[model samples]
Structures are given as C-alpha cells and as structure tokens.
Target: MPRIVDRDLEALRETALRMGSLAEAIVAKSLRALATADPLLCKEVQEDDLEIDRLDVAIDAAVLELLATKAPVATDLRFVLATKSVATDLERVGDLARNIAKSAARLAAAPRIELPGKLDQLAGECTRLLRRALDCYADGDPERARRVLDQDDLIDASESRVIRDAIAEIAAHPELSSQEIDLILIAKNLERVADHATNIAEDVILIAEARNLKHREKLERAGDRRT
Candidate 1:
C-alpha cells in the first residue's frame, strides 16, 4: 500500500509539470503573436496568463500545506523547495509572454517590422532554451538544465545582432522611425525571456547542489575589486 506521503509527492511532480507546460505554451503563443501581429493570438496569450497566475497561487498553497503538514526532510524537502522556486520562475515566464503579446497588440495596426531572419533564429533559440529548461526543471535533470544555460550565450549573441540591424534600419529609413522603438523593445523582451530560462537552469543546479551559484560572477567581481 502506498503511503499518503508518496501520493502527495507524485501529485507534486504532476503539478510541477503542469506549470512547466503552461509556461511553454505562453512562450510559443508569445512568439506567434510577435511573428504575426495577430490580435486574436495576442488576446489568447493574455487570457492564458490568468491560468498561470492561478496555478502559481495554487501551487504555492499546496507546497506550503505540504511543508506545514508533512515536515518533509532531506530529498523531500529539497523537492518541495525546488518546486516553489520553479513555480516562481514559471510565473515570471508567463508574465514575459503576456508582455510580448500586449506589445504585439499595440503594434497591430502599424506596418509590420519585417524582422530579419536573425530575429526568427533568435526566437527559435529562445523557444528551444525555454522548452529544455522547463523539461529539466520538471524532471529534475541537472544535466539538461546545464545545457540550457550553455545555449543562452548563443541566444544572447543573436539578440544583439538583430537589435543592431534593427537600429541600423531605423537610421537608414526615416519612415520606419516610429515603429523601430517598439520592434527593438520586442527584441529586448525576447532576450529577457532567454535570461529567465537561464535563471531556471541555475535554479535546477542550485536544487541539485544545495549551493547557490547565482552570485558566483558577482563574487568574482567583488574579489577583483578587493584585489
């Protein structure tokens, strides 16, 4: 016979996966909204965000209840803690998606920016990073999480290149001057989404090691300052 604790653990895993899927959906929809400037798609993204917020609240309540009632220790405690962190990251991801959608909605009536191929490539990279990071967090696969982090540099570079081209286009074409700012902002939003994916990967590493690497670079900078 399975213990209630065992059942609860299984439920926790399911809930975490659900949250991840919701986040992934948001990412995909946001990209569609960006690419198409479709008001309907943007509206869908906005509507989906309510569910993500609800899940975040429900997950937080469930995790808190488990902690208070179960007194979980060691690996169990780690799982619950990691789950809470994942929920937060997922919620933020949803918010980013909503922001992108809203921006697309605002630009709906304007002439399309005709983003270069590099923008599509950057978005694809971000989508991959987000999907992999979500999987890693869902399955507690630290290796996959690390790979997601490794891929972020490529996305960042691509974002920079696209933004540079957009800026140049704006300078060369005065007619596009008005929409360029929005396009640049959208590129920045996508870049930030990649950054959030990196944070999720870091959280996975932290959950596995019980050590925080988040400030590792900052610490190095501080050491250099002292030196």
Candidate 2:
C-alpha cells in the first residue's frame, strides 16, 4: 500500500500544480493582453480560461479521491484542505482573467486605452507575487509564502491610485467617460486577482507548518506580552 499511497500523493501534487500553472499563465497573459490590447493574445486568454475550468474539474476529482483513500491526517490532512482552498482561489483568479479577456474583446474595436502607470506597476507586482507563491507551494516553504502575503498591500495601494486617476479622467473628459469606466473595472479585476494569489500564499503557509501564520505579528506580540 505504500507504493499506492505514494502514487496517489504524486497524483494530487501533479493535479494541483497543473491547475496553479494555468491560473498563473492566465494572469500573466491576461496582463500582457491588457497592456498591449493585442487581440490575438486576448483570444488566447479566452481559450486558456476554458483549460482552467477543465483542470479545476479534474483536480477536484483527484482531491476527493485522495481524501477517501489516503485518509490523510495532521499535516497531510491540512495539505489536502489547503489544496482545495488554493484551487478555489485559483479558479476565481482564472475567472477574473476571463472577465478581463471578455472586456478586452468588447474593446477590441474601440480605441486602445494605455493602461495607467499605477495599474501597470500593479500588474508587475502581481506577476512576481504569483510566481513566488507557486514556488512556495511546490517547496512547502512558509517563509516565501509569508513574504507574498506581506507584499499584498503595495499592490492594493497601486490599485487605489488607479481608481482615483480613472475617476479624474472620466470627470475631465465627459465624452470618453464610458471608455474610462470599462478600463477602471478591468484594473480593479486585476487587483482582486493579486489578492487571490496572496490568499493562496497564506493558505500554503498555514498548511506546510500545520499552523496559522495569519496575523503572525500580532500572535508574536501576544506571546511576548504573556512572557
């Protein structure tokens, strides 16, 4: 049964990684399509979302099977739950990319709006955070996961700046108000995508150590006070 268990575990890992990679590619390619307004790339993202949905279905089945057969406990149990949770966030992120792609499709014929400076930087930050989060998951490294969660605020701030600028642009140019609004929504969707990636990182940290790293600083402070 040891060999069987090992094979099951490997299968679980492979499925999760495949799903995560698809989600990551969606974010990366969607951002590029957004930045460049390349119709071909946007169409690629549209097709990629279908692949993500397919993987989600496949991974979900693998997870349920593992639980039924492996009956993992303690850290392994936590890993199973965390895998489910991360897959959920990744699925949502995939949807967000698809939404952006759909929106881009609508604007394909409309004039290309250059992604604002803050939005561009936010996309760059998200790409890095997502890459690191996936690395942490594969290696079971809590420290790298925590770092991704810590850097989330920077992306959030950039998101806020874009919102403000978008509002200003719409107010200043009433004629392009509709166009400005669509771009604004796209930027917000990307910001939320980053947030979901951070959630995955946090989930990884919690699973790898069988401890909640959430509010970690507060927990440390409380320990100090008790001591």
After superposition on all C-alphas, the RMSD of every candidate to the true structure, in Å, is 3.1, 3.5
Q: lDDT by residue for model 2 over 76-183, one digit each (tens)?
A: 778877888778878888989888876676666677666677877877887777788888888889988888888877888888888899899988987767777777
Q: Mind giving the per-residue lDDT tens digits that candidate 1 earns over 117-210?
A: 8877887888788888877776778888888878877887888898888789888998987677766777787888788788888878777767
- Identify the leading candidate in terms of TM-score: 1
Error of 1 at 13 (Å): 2.2
| Whole-model alpha-carbon lDDT for candidate 2 | 0.79
**lDDT, residue 109, model 2:** 61
lDDT of 2 at 223: 82
Candidate 1: regions farther than 4 A off: 1-4, 224-227
Using lDDT as the measure, which candidate wins?
1
Candidate 2 wrongly placed segments (more than 4 Å): 1-4, 213-227
